[model samples]
Target chain A: MTESGHSSGGGMTARLVAAPRVRRGARQKVGDIVLSVVLIVLSLFMIVPLVWLITTSVTTRAEAFQLPPRWIPTPPTLANYAEINSLIPIGRMALNSLIVSVLATAGALLTSTLAAYAFSRIRFRGGNTLFSVLLAALMVPVQLTVIPLFILMRTLGLVDNLAAVWLPATVNVFGIFFLRQYFASIPRDLDEAARIDGAGHLRILFQIMLPLAMPALSALTIFLFEATWNNYFWPSIFLQSNEQMTLPVGLVQLQGAVGGGPAVVVFAAITAVVLPVLILFLIFQRSFVESIASTGLKA
Target chain B: MSSAPVAVSTVRRRGIEGRSNLAGWFFVSPAVLLFIVFIAGPFVAAMGLSLFSWDLLTPARFVGMENFTRLFGDATVWLSLRNTFVFAFASVVTHIVIGLALAVAVNRPLHKVVQYVTRSAIFFPFLISWAAVSLLWKYVLDPDFGIASYYLGRIGITPPNWLIDPQWALPALIGIDWWHTIGYTFVILLAGLQTVPGIYHEAAKIDGANAWQRFWHVTLPIMAPTLVFAMIITFIGAFQIFEPMRIITDGGPSDSTRSIVLYLYQQAFESFQVGYASTIALVVFAIVMIVTLLQLRLSRRWMGHD
Candidate 1:
């Protein structure tokens, strides 16, 4: 984009366009070659640890810490993967993580979008004040509310339950703030037109506003999914039972179970834990990165 | 559809009052109820709990100011407070410097491909779970059969026990903390870097400014708001550090690495000192608030990156 902009501005009018075009082509090729080499080297660094993790996971415990590390395991096996069930309820933990993440993401998106819509379009007494307080709520560290939440859950007899982990996280200030930032940008004319057609507020939000909010909603969903999936602290404290552990907590359990196993096994456990998230990231790298980047700028 | 809300049930004069106020309340009821019960109510309850010293087993008794008074006299709590502050500040400083450096280095227009790779490589660590990173580093830094120690031993240097020794443990934990979250800071900083137009750099170059001069004069000011914003988040996150210490040291080696959060966790969970733990949590909150205000005051003259 930068190079094209420079070329378009500098050489198009004075010199023959063909000569400048050739120079631009040469520069672009040179740039691409350098870029490819650099990217490959960097990409290798990003990928090698992952490759090592996979290799280490499949290798025997005895071969884990050979004086010189083995890049590949001969006769690779799934013994380590199989050990997960015997060691702990690893499959159940994965399911718990999936359930909690999906439910929290859905709940968060619904509540936040409703609140965001109300804040963006509706005018009520103390509405702006409430919104300002919510913004301040974003800056309040999670720890402030965490202790209170624990007590609340304990009092409600909801401790050690998945619902305890999912409820508070569902109504986050950041989600409201994020969706509001986007929703505020949506033109209000369509909303007014819908209202004139006798469409109610809920109808406007669903039929008119939501369709235009696909980009922001998708971004929010991706962000929420990643966050809830990776969330550790609340679940750690809330879910005391092994069966209820999420992937992050389960990985910790796996680490403990190894009880000083070969480095390869530990690496394997970590690999198992990180794999799903990494795959998801690779698939939605653009959305993952853009959601965060756009949100940060929105702040 | 024609019978929607019994539109014709009421007489014309009273029809305006026919709409259910309950419906509007119902629309927002779930969120309002959850927020009050889970957030606002707990926060108020915590404040009240901070004033008492109940262990959840004995009958409730009020002990106003005793818990806070005990906290003042408790050397361990004080030590934990200091350690927590140092850990938080060091990690925040390291993250900002290293993250900003990585962002600026890779933010260059000259090496677009290199920039992409550098950004991706740096961010790769951020995706790794905190426990995994902690375990990986614990092993790597382990004295026996550890890769880091193995390399150091070749030069006839013995590696100190990272999670065991009192003096070295906190620093080791800090180093790992920096590594775990530096990618997050870098990503945020890089996003900020993307917004600064290249035209400013071009104009600076036309003025015959050196690279260092251009960065200090043009880039820094433009990036100030972002730097401040990232710093605030980093400060808060650092102060709340818990997972790694919980996994790696468990606040061991005579409790040198015990952070305020860890102390709170142990107090509440291990000892079941709910009231005392709430008090400690309040102190932690106070510390965070004061430090943030102080930092905001300090950054006012130079920092405007909000």
Candidate 2:
């Protein structure tokens, strides 16, 4: 009887695990199929407009206006792309955007990393209070500061220059916060060992800490680059001259110049302006999603 | 000899501490300087500028409390504030509900390729700049020769002139904003959902809890903090909505869709009422701070984090 009971107990344990699997399999199959269908519909909602934009870019002015709008361009052509360049130096504006965004990203990464290292590793007087004040700065809207900043830029003769668009943005609170958290996570013994080897604070930060924090730095770089690249409001306000205008501000002028003309040309201009950043995003999609997700969770 | 060595070590320690302190200051100086010059200085200047009237062309004159009083009486300010609140509220609600639903759907047991493709498709629009999004929608929503109109007509419904019709303009902008931004919220919620341990669901299932009960009891509580974070950020962003209105409608056929930021821009640039615009900016700042603080306080009660 004892042997039979032991055999029954073993069977009970096996059934406990396997029973749920069999039940869940039947239920989850239906759920998964329904969920997949819903997700496909939602994905289409997101993708169709972009596909439409691309199709519209290649369509002729007359075909663009046809009812039951064409899903695919009929005899797709590159004429609209050519027309955009002639109307407003689209290539020059894209280059301007690239230069400003790259410089701003570099400057921000430098300043934020240095400051984050100091804040995370060094125990100076009032450091916590100072860091709190920096955090508070995040809550202040850019709108409140724009008027005075614009005036200050004008006084410094930086208006209508790319400096005006990027200077104020070079010091970012979010970047500092993100990197500081990363620095704090690093083990203290590493810094202690470096100190014993007679490494200076700058040496330690540059050589030891930075290499270990490359993941965080790359994520921050992508975030800052995307933000600076897509920046519109600040560039619009700071840049007045057509020659100094970035892609976003230039696109607005192109829109005004087109004046309800061929939809295809405007579509072409939009596509050209957005394609570089879109490509960058696709390449670094993991970094983009990870950084944003972590920021949200940590905040 | 022992005393001598101890004293030498003491002096060396002091020297190292002092040198490191100096280095700390040096490292942080650039960020501190930029912050003071750009952020802190402008904030104070905005406060001062609101008390004096000056067009960039002329000498400033002090007019204490006049801008504030003028803001109080300005009907356009009231109108813009009301519209902003409506847009912001609708944005927060729709984004949370739809984003959570999307996250739940994607979090289910589905094929790996479908999961990745769905996520990429949903998030693609978010990477594009607001300027491009605003323009793209303008073409799609055009009353004549627009695809939206064409499709709606095919389904036997007349599409209103979206950007022109006062009643539909704000709703149209809201819809465009959802298309532009819901991906961000989805990704955030998806991350949150992934963090909820599967053991809790298994236990709940053993207790014979149904799917809805498990979600309501186990999933919601575990995801509370993330939901709160997403909600607050979404509210903050929605309140600052400017690009769509400025680009598509230009504050509309009847001033129905003018956001507070657009109003401030018009006052400062078009009318040259720099002082009054600063006052408006201050009001916007105060409202955002108070609402954020209030949300934090309220979340504690429901978030179950003592």
Candidate 3:
């Protein structure tokens, strides 16, 4: 973009252009190469541990324990992966994680979009105050609220239930704030035309607004799903029983019990936990980066 | 009488204005209800609970100012608070410096493939949960037959028991935390960097300014707010550090790595001290707000100078 921009500004005097262009060539070429090298080095630093993780996961337990640690498992086996089931209810836990993530993400999408639409478009009694309160809640860290939530769950006889996990996840104050901003940026004229055609708020949101905000909404969905799936703190603290525990919590237990001795099992558990999100990120790499980038630009 | 009833019904229904107001309420009610039930109501209840002593099994009995007074004298509280500050401080510094460096390096007009690989590599660790990354490092840093020991031994340096030794444990956690989260800060700054107009650098160049001068005078000023935003979020996240200590260290080796949040959890769950935990919760809340406000004030001066 920068280079193209420079070329398009060709209207500048030849001397001005030529001087910098020459300097840019010599200086920038050297600088960029330096930075490129730096980038690769940093990239390698980030990737090596992940490589070690995958390699270690595939190795046999005996090979894993061996000194001058085998980078390549001499006859890589899935025995550890098979043993993971007897070790813990790994499959069931994955299903629990999946179910909770889906439910929470869906609920968040529905509730936040509705609230965002109302906040952005409609002027109602107490609306501003309500929105302000929601924003104010952002200052209160989620960790602080857990004690109260635990009590609340206990009071409601939901001490060990998944409800305690998913209910709070479904409504994020930040999500409402973000989608409101995104929805507001959209030209009101687009929705105004729909209103003129006798369309209702629901129709306007679903048909006109949501389609336009799909990129942002999907980005939000990706974030919420990953967070809920990867969440360990709340689930670990609240859900005591194994059946209700999500993958993150379950994987930790698998380590505590059977993963104590076999390094391979531990690595395999971590890999299994990380793999789904890694694959999703690869598939949606462009938009995920864009959404994150765009978020930063907002502040 | 029939006409009167009809007229009253029409006025009550009141066409677009009334109906639209109802619609607005309907739209926002779910979120509002969630706020009231989960956040607002629980917060108030917890505040009340702080003024009383109660185990989970027993009925509440009021004991005013006891938990509050107990909080200041608690030695573990101070230790945990100090550890939290240290962790948060180290995390913020490392993340901002390294993340910005990575972003600036990537932002230069690199090849498309180079850009993609750098981004994916940086973000990959961040995608994994804290539990996994913490455990992964715990294994990697295992003193016996672990890679850290193996490699460092070759250089004739004995690696300390990374998780067991008090001195090395916190630093080890700090390094792992940096590895896990630097990507988030990088993406944020990269986004901010792109928002910097190319023309500013060009104008600076035309004035015979060097690269450093351009970055300092032009780019830094433009990027200050975004950098502050990144720092604030990173600090908040760091301050709430729990998973790593809970999983790997278990707040061990003379209580070196016990953060405020982890301490609060143990106080509540392990000891069943709900009232005291609520008091600790308030402290956490107060500290976060005060520090965040302080950051905002400092950022004002920071941006003003730039």
Please give the fraction of native interface contacts (Cα pairs under 8 Å between A and B) kept by each candidate. Answer: 0.29, 0.67, 0.68
Regions of candidate 1 where Cα sits further than 4 Å from its true position:
A1-51, B1-28, B110-113, B152-158, B291-306
Backbone clash count, each prediction separately: 3, 0, 0
Task: Give the lDDT ranking, best first.
Answer: 2, 3, 1
Clashes of 2: 0
DockQ of each: 0.31, 0.66, 0.63
Q: What is the clash count of model 1?
A: 3
Each model's C-alpha lDDT? 0.75, 0.86, 0.84
Query: Residue B266 CA error for candidate 2 (Å)?
Result: 1.0
Two-way DockQ contest, 1 vs 3, winner: 3
Q: Chain B TM per candidate, please?
A: 0.86, 0.93, 0.90
lDDT of 3 by residue, B1-306 (tens): 669999877887676567778889999999889888888877787788889897888888899999999999999999999999999999999999888878878888888888999999997787788878877887778887567778789999988988889998999999999999888899998888888999999999879998789888998899888888888889988998999999988887789999999998998999889899889988888887877777668777876751
> Which CAPRI quality tier does the interface of model 3 achieve?
medium
- Residue-level lDDT tens digits of model 1 in B1-306: 978557556564254333323334444455566666666677778888887777777865788988889888989898888888888889878988978866776675545656656666666677777867777777667676555667677788887887789999999998877766776788899888888999999899768787689889998998987888788778888888898888888888898888889998888878978788888888877767776676566566665453
Give the CAPRI rating of model 1.
acceptable
Question: In terms of DockQ, which candidate is stronger, 1 or 2?
Answer: 2
Worst 10 residues of 3 chain B by lDDT: B297-306
Error of 1 at A127 (Å): 1.6
State chain A's TM-score for model 1. Answer: 0.85
Candidate whose lDDT is highest: 2
Estimate the overall C-alpha local distance difference test score of candidate 1: 0.75
